[model samples]
Target: MSGVNEDYNAISSVYSQISKLPLMVLERQLVAHALSSCKGQTILDLGGGNGIHARKALELGASSVDVVDISSGMLKDGKTITAASGVNPAMIRWFEGDISSTLAHLPLHKSYDVILVGWTFDHAETEDQLLGMWRNVTTYAATGAKLINTRLAYIPKAEETDGIEKYGFLYPDYKEIPGGISYTYEAFTDPPLRCPATSLTNTLDFDESKSIARQHGFRDYQVVDSEQMDVVKEDPAFWRRFVDQP
Candidate 1:
């Protein structure tokens, strides 16, 4: 499930339990691939919840990491976790701001080496709002910067959601909206959490993002195949359903 502002404030701790899921394990592998060459790079993690991926970037040698999200509660949780761990929390800066809008005027650096937008776009409620999130990404990116992001690629039918719960979250109760669709993304944390989300029809194929990035001067956008990932290749059967629906 994507962390969209206030939706996660009360359940932030419950939300972090997603790390124990198999699909999340593979997803982290993808994130590790994106950050593999991020040593010495400055990074911006939009929609970064509790500094999870932000800390990973720090471990991978990021000189600085700025985490921007809309939830003050989640931001507080990040600082708490960092403080408890007693790591270089000073190296990572946390800011409470919305990525769908309001990131440009914030005191953020304009050019980052790598920008990570982890599942933020799916929360866009309209076309303009969705594009607003893209605007933030491009506005802060450097001229040769790489962007590793997750867009809502597909909205599954309720019937197709049968076996996805084991992955820690299941999006059900699909409802068609003006631009695309809306659904409830339920994370199977001990005491579950739900977030109503939207995904645009045009954006479902990922072309909307590619075009936006290109217009902003990015060179390329490639969709990496999970099947080729070593995590999945090692045991395809174990990750079969997730690879199919993820």
Candidate 2:
């Protein structure tokens, strides 16, 4: 399987486990709060793995959500979970493709009121690629729309051991590439698979990300760190450990 596919496949299988962690739960809460403020009826979940955020949007009264991801396995798992949870499956539209291409061709009655690019834009390998992603998002965003993105601020220089113990995954290899950092992990699969998780936006800091958003015509961009969120601030040690890799 391709790198992204394999990693996400393994991730989907353990989605339930990892998502229970305080860090992950806090992330979701923060995102949900952001969605609630948007008052958006239509939402676009870019790189939405297993409809996690999509379901939240629905719970917050979003009429419909379109989930676009590169991993079909993740989407399948998400569909099953959401259906089981009693969310109308029809309310969530799943698309399996790259975000850049998928958004360009997605057929919708109107532009999306809220666009959630959660923890996905860091995959872009270059400034141009990151800008392209914002442009693609802009193509589908309604006027006076809001775009919220969450990304890792810094890549650790060393391998992490605690992630495997806590989340059942370990990034054992770290390499500094041209644009960002590359991490290699051996995900705990039914039959284990080697997965390389790379972040191409390693060079993009908070200011740069906001600048890119502005260049693409998105205004009032705000960058919020997890530490600043009420849910995460309560447990400084956990978040500090999470951000500080081994």
Candidate 3:
């Protein structure tokens, strides 16, 4: 719950409600597009809290998934949900450890076909820690494996709001920290939940991040445009604010 990884032990129960937010539409779209080529493939979901997207991967035709997270509570919650939903719990392996430092020691026996990094990298408090995350990416991912990820890259430090409320979730203004910005990411649900997130500039900077990716054996890094997604094309007016700000 601190430093390179913000353990979500306290808010694990309500965190699943994040999918209820309107912005989740785009997230699902991204996942759908990312997983289009992953049929019968294996996946490694770093920071895959509560198996939300992990289950989505299975639904999208992934053969197996390994969900690594820093929170035991989140893993437990995922297991409970997987068991209750009658989705063979064995399909998803829940491992609790910081993705930044534990990939080598974790029980990841093979390189994956796809690596998921969404809602994962922002917690790094320093550039070295951020590199630690990309390091893990290169570790379990072999050449030709797809790496798909996303985050709130833009920092609305000046404006109070970026018109994101309609898209769901409340991302308040962030304050500058040593090497990043810190803010409470709030999801509006019954008995609301908030996560104190730290997004470093190094993590946000495209040049720097992609530089590290290339240096560490990653290639063909490209940012997918959100405007062209079917979800956005279906309703431009509704998704304007999110796509514009996102």
Query: lDDT per residue, candidate 2, 98-212, as tens digits?
Result: 7745355666546888888987775665556665667668887889888877765655545435433343445557887787777765445445545565666532466766676
Please report, in order, the local distance difference test score of every candidate based on alpha carbons: 0.80, 0.70, 0.79
Q: What is the lDDT of residue 176 in candidate 2?
A: 76
Full ranking by lDDT: 1, 3, 2
Q: Tell me each candidate's TM-score.
A: 0.91, 0.82, 0.91
Model 2 residue 2 lDDT score: 37
Clashing pairs in 1: none
Worst lDDT window (10 residues) for model 3? 1-10
TM-score of 1: 0.91
Ten consecutive residues with minimal summed lDDT in candidate 1?
Answer: 1-10
User: How many steric clashes between backbone atoms does each model show?
Assistant: 0, 0, 1
State the local distance difference test value for candidate 1: 0.80
